[model samples]
Target: MVTITVTRKSQSFVAPSELTPSEMLELSAIDRVPGLRHTVRSLHVFRHKDAADRVASRPAEVIRAALSRALVDYRPFAGRFVGSVVAGETCVECTNDGAWFVEAVADCSLDDMNGLDYPLMVSEEELLPAPEEGVDPTSIPVMMQVTEFACGGFVVGLIAVHTLADGLGAAQFINAISELARGMDKPTVTPVWARGLIPNPPKLPLGPPPSFQSFGFGHFAMDVTSDRIAHVKAEYFQATGQYCSAFDVAIAKVWQARTRAVRYNPEVEVHVCFFANTRHLLTQVLPKDGGFYGNCFYPVTVTATAGDLAVAGLLDVIRMIRDGKARLPLEFAKWTSGDVKVDPYELTFEHNVLFVSDWTRLGFLEADYGWGAPSHIIPFTYADYMAVAVLGAPPVPKKGTRIMTQCVEEKHLMDFKDEMKALF
Candidate 1:
């Protein structure tokens, strides 16, 4: 086993290089959802490269300077989340508080950790930054750590509160930092903070905020190769006479296989919830140029009985997922207009709910900070819920998607693996 040691060199706050607005910024209803109150964490791994100059070899200094510039436009990220007088609402107090930054050094190279691939060998605590024991995580909207390895390679770990942005929006913020690090004056696509454009929900009764709870799930990484996905897509098209996306087939297979492996009671209700991007759906309100950096995706859930999922054909499962995604526009409208009473953030694990997040199109790999694009991008840790992360595999000749899942218990883990293997 390879043991990697990381030492912290410095810790400080990175405020915006230029002065930003000092006012309260009201977050959209989607941003203030109770479920998204937690922090989102990720790690970006970059390989060692020969540099022309000494200053260019240091990634920490370059990123620190670039992050300061990036915060000028994304000022909301530097602010803290404050509760609103209105029930079930939170807003960002843009006090220019600044983001937390850490510089660290790792004693090993990427190769020592298997190219920083799936089944991450290093501890998340070593790579990601965290708040002190008494500090509230939400008070720091963003925290970043850059850990350079002995071989000159580095890893960038980030933690951002979900209320500030979703996967795409967060990627936009990081990309801006990358642009500035690469000597660009500004980001390619300017960010827009049109939070009010998303209609607010009518005043609703406030409830106790949700807390994180772990179910002791055995986490596993399942790689679905491109060839396997292609074969499944072909089979689906032949059976349904309709085309389906890679995500549709992949998620359907996992949901079906998991339901069967868990052996839930026939009458037990099972649900698979995934977020659908509303950028195109809300083009009238959001910019089409991809500048709206906020939480614009909403959850769409497909529910069925365990017995039905176990017996249903793959094509049928895919159709159910398709139908669920198709309802995003209407469901989002109802949610915004106060017609739907269901709180999207009030999630239940109960071993029956699967929350799948697709990060394949989030543009995390494009964050090239002078060295080059990162070779791999992965979440720092899985959520306590039965979470499934669909991420793009590391850059390789044979491309594939890595599905990191934490749903099955230890006893049923082998059965779940077998079921997934038999599908391909």
Candidate 2:
């Protein structure tokens, strides 16, 4: 019922002039480091009829206006990763490849878009979380349409570079768009650009930012799905087991069992790195909802192998991850300009990624444009070994967990349901 009108446009999504000193420092860090111009992180979904109708009536002028305002108001651009130092986004668009646009492949039964990859796999064995008590199903981000098909189904998608913002960051952007549609003012909190988190690059500095090689092996760029993935989670608690969420408990037990099964060197700096937004550590604290909307999450990590962690208590694992998150503020040393050059590291991994993102709290489906909010949003559209999307689902008896996985070890993935039974 609400309407929004766009009245302004800016060349870059972010007005570099508005950046505070620290924010500039943060942005500067990105400039110093090289970025991966390709393989942007994006999410896509297919929409049904009524929703497509609502989108169809919406003019590109209004939508583009809304997007521009969203860019300025929320500035998803601010959180994006400029290309790598060696193979970064071209300083100019004409010189740049298709690096600026979010690239997604949607291939349904139809053949409209030149580069759309359809849903390759769908499974009935998996479960879905029930939509919250009263949320509309169509408003979900995964349900938005990139381009409506002649058959009436619509394709919608989201592209985010891991270095920029992760699932939480993308979710915040979607929610802001919804708020704009309702004519809401700028979010109460502005985004704290992480660039400032980096210390001033050395007087001369180590040239540009570190490239992918400086960190580790090559990066990941695949398309995964349920049909392609093999994963399973079960709800279980032993009479003597510790109290914890299913993820914490299961991972703990698995680690314990795995370590006992193998030998690991204690000297190794192995860790479990998960997200906990470090917005406050940035140069400036924007409004609570700065840039995007959602809870400020931080990456929680721990160092343990199959055996040690698997045998740990539930409360213990929770406490450990909590402590790891608290230490996030310590990482602000980059802002302080430590001796080590700033190198952004992505927590995602191939054949070994464990994402425990809670989408319900992300406010993704709550943000409605003109028509309504998205009913469902799912990650793990790429090919992979293990990936989990923790969002609300409707069919499971209790809250359900949707796991997506792809790997050479089909046995490890196909044994998911059995693993759930074992975890229980």
For each candidate in turn, the TM-score is 0.94, 0.54
Error of 2 at 30 (Å): 6.5
For model 2, the superposed segments whose C-alpha errors exceed 4 Å read: 1-65, 72-145, 149-153, 163-166, 181-270, 280-289, 292-300, 310-320, 330-360, 381-400, 405-408, 415-417
Best-fitting candidate, scored by lDDT? 1
Write model 2 residue lDDT over 1-424, tens digit each, in one string.
Answer: 1121211111112122233122211233333323222222233333333654455453222333444455553443533222334543222111111112111222332233322232323221111211234833221212122333344443334444433444556666666555555556664345554434333434423344322222121111122222211222122223324333434443443333233323344433335545555556652644444553322344455665444454565445545654555577776444345544433332334323344444445555555555454434555433232333332332112244333322223334334434334443
Writing each residue's lDDT as its tens digit, candidate 1 over 1-424 gives 9888999899888899999989998888788776677788888889876556534448999999999999999998888888952354688988887899999998888889887786679778889986667988767889999999988899999998888899899999999999999889999989999988877777566555544567677877777788888888898889878888889988898899889988999999999988888888788877677699898887888999999999999889999999898888898888777886666645665568888888888888789898888887878447665555454564443478777778788888899899888876
RMSD of each: 2.1, 11.6
Candidate 2, run of 10 with poorest lDDT: 92-101
Task: Score each candidate by Cα lDDT.
Answer: 0.83, 0.38
Which one is best on TM-score? 1
Q: In candidate 1, which residue ranges exceed 4 Å CA deviation? A: 51-55, 84-86, 204-213, 387-389, 395-398
| Model 1: lowest-lDDT 10 consecutive positions | 389-398
